[model samples]
Target: MSQPNTSPSGRPATLAPLFKASAGDPLLAMMLASGGDERIAAGPDGRNRYGASARPEAGEIWFSSSTASGVSRRGWQAASAALPFAFSAGESEDWFSDLRRRLLNLLAPPGAQAVFCASGTQAEYAALALAGARARPGQKIVNILVGPEETGRGAPLAASGRHFLNSAPFGSGRAGFALDGWEGAAALAALPLRNGAGAPLPADEIDARVCALVRVARARGAHALVHLLDSSKTGLSAISRDCATKLLRDNPDDVTVVVDACQLRCAPAQVRADLDAGFLVMVSGSKFLGGPAFSGALLVPGGFAESLAARDQDIPWPEGLADHFAYFDWPPLLRDRIAGPFGARCNSGLGLRWTAALAELEAYCALDPALIEMAKACFQGEARRQILMTPGLEMDESGGEPTLIPIMMRGAEKGAADAALRKLRRRGLHLGQTVPIGGREALRLCLSAPQIVDFAWRYREIGDQNFAFGPLRADLEKLFTAWGALLG
Candidate 1:
């Protein structure tokens, strides 16, 4: 492999490796190849199948982390740094194990474990498998997904123990078949977070519905895998943490609560709290963390694996799972619990992607907590203000953090919103994809951790008084200006 040219600061002189890692060993090829199916495939136009390129583009404003983002400079550097080592340790467990350890240290509480997957949807599939393994012999697995419309398109299929995609990340293609040993093992129940009017339902109403479903599942000898959505696509959470806790306490044996924190927009403390409460948490590096797409992990609370171990029930590993996950994906404690001749290999791309994401996360976490909150507040307030002030655009007022702002075009025809999105992208302003809210389709303006950290640094350098007049507001100004032109 050719060596990267370095400058006096010891950084690569160019981002060549960031876009395409230098070829040395065959393992580097595997790392680049593992971005998964159509989700990350680049098209003939040099863009990924998602219409975004793998490499970061200059002057392209990215407000799309609520869906996906190209690899940020920080993430790219981290991935580049890992390349040499990843090549050296081809298929070895050391690199993957260390990646898992780093993830747990950064996001999990003590004794917590993590199962890495190729994407958030894949993590959902892993969660279902774990829930299915824990079900009693006579009990059926009933998956209760919150905010199904706002979550991944493939989530329902994954929750039902079927292949959500035509091809798995690891190069296995089996579109709609039930996973091996999983046929007739699980059923899906969806609880919409919003009512028919596109209005968010009351928390109490959502809680009541969840309780009713859990009770029904329990009465029917079913294990209820209820999801607590921390943040959906447009940043709306369905069930409150307190409600999830109560349901778990009321039906500990029959209830399995998984927090769909795939957006990863909540605080680390919130995730630790979920783990402390014995709930499985799913997080994505590709979302708010601003990593390259297709990086996700399922966080297992401490002692949860031991509990599964104690069950000693012979849980047959679904043969289809071998296509999506490798042996190293699970922590040591879980490897032996599910019996199967699974792949004893490692996914180098998964490792590299996590490495990149952890870089962004660590940098963001290194900033002052107060500063982080302040930056988010300023950005959200300004972005919301601009969106409201813009003509022909209305904000979707579902209760969520300001990180993701969903706005709809007034009187837009069917599919016009999507065309407008393409127009905005062509004009060099990138926002989130269109999401359906009630009868209207809305586009999102999202804020990522890297964006916050960037603003925070500028804020610190320029002092608090000049902060408001700085780049943060300037970015919002640029966004609203482009939006207004599109409306015109």
Candidate 2:
């Protein structure tokens, strides 16, 4: 097969194949088919409406991982390599099992298991299914969602056990309908991380709100699923890990805490710690991991799945989930326990996405810890400084990790910020979508694993002095210059 045509500068043309295939491979086609409604539609130019293409477009500047990112070259190669194993007859099951194991080995502790989902929102639904399955007869699952405003738009609906979007990622269901067997099985209690003024609530106050919600659930003999936000869109953590640990300890039978680390800005150590504390962790490879968009997983702590399997009571599989999850999505121990008619199938696109993500993650994990920190610090510090110095922009001071910087547009009208974003796009620069902060909307400048890795390689080549005056600073200067022109 001939390689897809490229421009003189080696950038892929608008209608280039998603991969380097001369002819369309059915397995490769599944990569684009694995996501939700949003992933399926593309404009005439062969890019999504968001102006992102499945293949890497070297000409575009991407700082939009907080929203979505085009696949990195490294990730694309990894996915391409896995095509044979994924397509091999009878090997698909083992392929998926291997993927689940690889992910756990890299991101979780011993005995941990994972179930793949197409997106973070679907992972929320998977968590809900698990919580619901464990609930005693007549017990309501009280879903305590932290910082819903700062998370995915569909997250609250997923927490309530309904389809977050109009179309399911895999299965068939109308939006707003309860998952099969989940009708009236759950209730939602939202705890906004920020106050009315858009300032993040104090950790103590946030902790109190979580505890109060759990108390109310307990009073009603409900099962409490506390959705803790490790990092939000603007880099805010709503509840402290200490609070989550105490809640689980105080009510071991009734409370289940799940960490929403979807942004994946924190260290791997943090994820392990959450699993160690007996909390479920949800992460997205598409975010800070810098994989192609729509890869997600629900990390199950050691002994959790085993315990669920050991229960003598009948654990009825939620029929509604059949549309969203496959039989092999769960670990072997629980697969048979889930009495569903769904066959042993999996999402090929999801497997490919994770393959790409693991490639990026392994490369990232191989770097010296100090070097990674240095790159992150330098990038964050430089970005913050530039945002402060730029006219018509102000930074969000609610601090978490420095990986994502959200900046507000000063004195801009309702549509002006969006217009600036489009202008930036035309200039070959992309940023995170605007997020509503208190009364204002802010655009996020995000860092990804590939970006850091690129810096690491350059830093090694040029040494300290030249590295300081090199591409990292130059890129930021260019970004801010384009940004400033739009504001003017």
lDDT of 1 by residue, 175-263 (tens): 66787767888899998988898888888899889889998998888999999999988887878889899988988788889999988
The stretch of ten residues in a row with the least summed lDDT in candidate 1 is: 1-10
Q: Write the per-residue lDDT of candidate 2 for residues 261-284, one digit (tens) a residue.
A: 999888888899899999999999
Q: List the residue pairs that clash in candidate 1.
A: 41-49
- Model 2: pairs clashing at backbone N, Cα or C within 3 Å: 171-323
lDDT of each: 0.80, 0.79
Write down the worst ten-residue block by lDDT for model 2: 1-10
